[model samples]
Target: MTVLSDTSIKKAVLSGELSILPFHDDALQPASYDMRLYWKILISPMRHENGRTVDLRKEPNHTFFVEPGRFVGILTEEKISLPLSMVGRFGLRSEFTRHGLVAFGGIQIDPGFKGRLAISLFHAGPELIPLKLGRKMFTVEFNQLADQASKGYDGPFQNQSTFHKMQKDFILNAHTTSLAEINTLPSEIASIQHRLTMHETFYHPKREFPSISELAKAQGVSPINDITELSGLLSEEDDIDTFLETVQKWRRGNNNDE
Candidate 1:
């Protein structure tokens, strides 16, 4: 098998050996063809479920943001078809890769395949990646096989129409969890837990409060040795009413002594 040069690639496309719709002269490269971004996209929802997305074709904007630390699926502007004798290899354009965009896709296009390419993109960069419609995002190089395989590709994704039809938008451990929001979840949970702990310490700190016996000793009262009486007053817990009564009585006795 030999890699097809630009001239050979053009000849094959012209002769129907390789089919690409909406091909542009500018997109033709020295040894490959550029694939443009299509209008439709399904982004990882902003911390939400239900895949609930919008079609960019219907919207006024021609751009979508590949948010930082999130993944998105997009379609190619051109439809592709390849004969069994030729295999294609594709990758994200270096322009997009320079900005921390990672594209997940198969390395080779199986023969006898026809469909719009679905590229899943992840933004590992710090900022949003604004991708415009019709932008050339991928470069695909074709190679001619010396011998055509016995069978053509007939997998589940052979003739997929849309990105959604090709694969799931995102796979997460929790169904209600959103991959886009995964970055901020730990901080949010920590904040809530801290607040709850602070509230509990401020309002209900029985663990830190002294017991009735310790209070009696501090006040110079006699060693009230009856466990039954202690239980009656404390009731297996710290009784605020009992604590208040005991303090009041001690204070009154101290006043008398003064």
Candidate 2:
């Protein structure tokens, strides 16, 4: 299969083998055609803005803001129809890619497809991007298949002239969280953990808890395992661990009858 040049593309259009409605000469390239942004609208869910929809039929604003991290869907100004012998490749212009515009859609137009393209896009730049109506944003490159496919394109999206229901739902229920805020969650969690463990260690860090072994070393070399010795040492010992060890020594000696 070979890609169609601008001259060949026009011939195919003139012959009714390919279709590009409302076509403009300036939009044609060496081997592709640029599709302009439709004036219908761009919907972004904004906690700051009062509403979620952008019905241009009522509103006078012709431009939409793609804030950092918000996902939005847009339509092309032209409708396309491809014959069974022709297929197409699709993507956004490189100029928009440099500004951190990520375009999302199927890259291939199946043979004999007829539809207006609806593209999902996100602005990932540090600042917000304002997109005006009729702006050139997408490109479609037509190519001729070696032979006509045995079958023609007949998918759920075929003859799609407007946004799909799924696309509408996405805009209707978009989350307000920005990607920038999501990135800092790990550090925020780490800070909370450190706060819970702040300050000097409780009691002593030498051992998990004070034991009879620690007491034995503090008072004398060997344990005082006699009851009479324990009663006298307990009266003098002020520390909790020392007092516990004094009682333990007497209990061990009595149990073993030593």
Candidate 3:
């Protein structure tokens, strides 16, 4: 098997031997091309037997946050078609790995496979990770097979270009566990509800507590809605840690004044 070089990959794409819809020349790397994250993702519900699909496009800014230790399935933005002569290997980009995200599940594209790749992403980092729509999250490296298979891939996953729910039978049969583990759904939901209720009681916008902007103003500082806006307010010489410390001091002063 020979791994395709950047030049060969471009040639194959141009000659119609390979197809990557909505391709961008800038996405081409030295050996692989970057694939962006799509808008939809599948996540395991509190119940182990059920799964849920989340569409980030329905949310503001087409952004979704994945909590640490959560596992979700995402699709690639580009639909790819591979001829029988080639196979594709998918891998997580280094940038995401640095944030402790690991890609799991189907990593290899069988010859003749045609679809947007489905990827299972596991967040192993300590902090929540934000995934933005259309951001490159993975890379695909194409390789020429030694010989074309007599029969092309025609598996259950062929042409799976959208978020797909895991079949119930597949889940029940694939992973066997004790009855206790299978019955934790109710407790999990209750726990989640309790946390949400507490959060609403303490921090909901409707509560009497002053908004971040109001607090900032009371402390004689510009209001900051988010980390991005806070960063913008800082000079190049000002480090984020120092700025955050100053904000904390101001917040404390405002509380004392109150």
Best by lDDT: 2
Candidate 3 structure quality by residue, lDDT tens digits, 83-126: 99999999889988999888767788999998888877767776
Estimated TM-score for each candidate: 0.70, 0.66, 0.62
Q: Residue pairs in steric clash, candidate 2? A: none
> Per-residue alpha-carbon lDDT of model 2 for 126-240, expressed as tens digits?
6767677788888999989999888888987789888888776776566566666678889989998876666334433456566788777886769557767655544454777
Ranking by lDDT: 2, 3, 1
lDDT of 1 by residue, 12-120 (tens): 8899888999778789999999999888776664455545454666655777676676667777889889898988888899988999889887868888888888877
RMSD of each: 9.1, 10.5, 27.3
- lDDT accuracy of residue 89 in candidate 3: 94
| Model 1 lDDT, full chain set | 0.77
Off by over 4 Å in 3: 46-51, 167-258
> Once superposed on the true structure, which residue ranges of model 2 sit more than 4 Å away at CA?
48-51, 56-61, 179-258
For candidate 2, give the lDDT of residue 148. 89
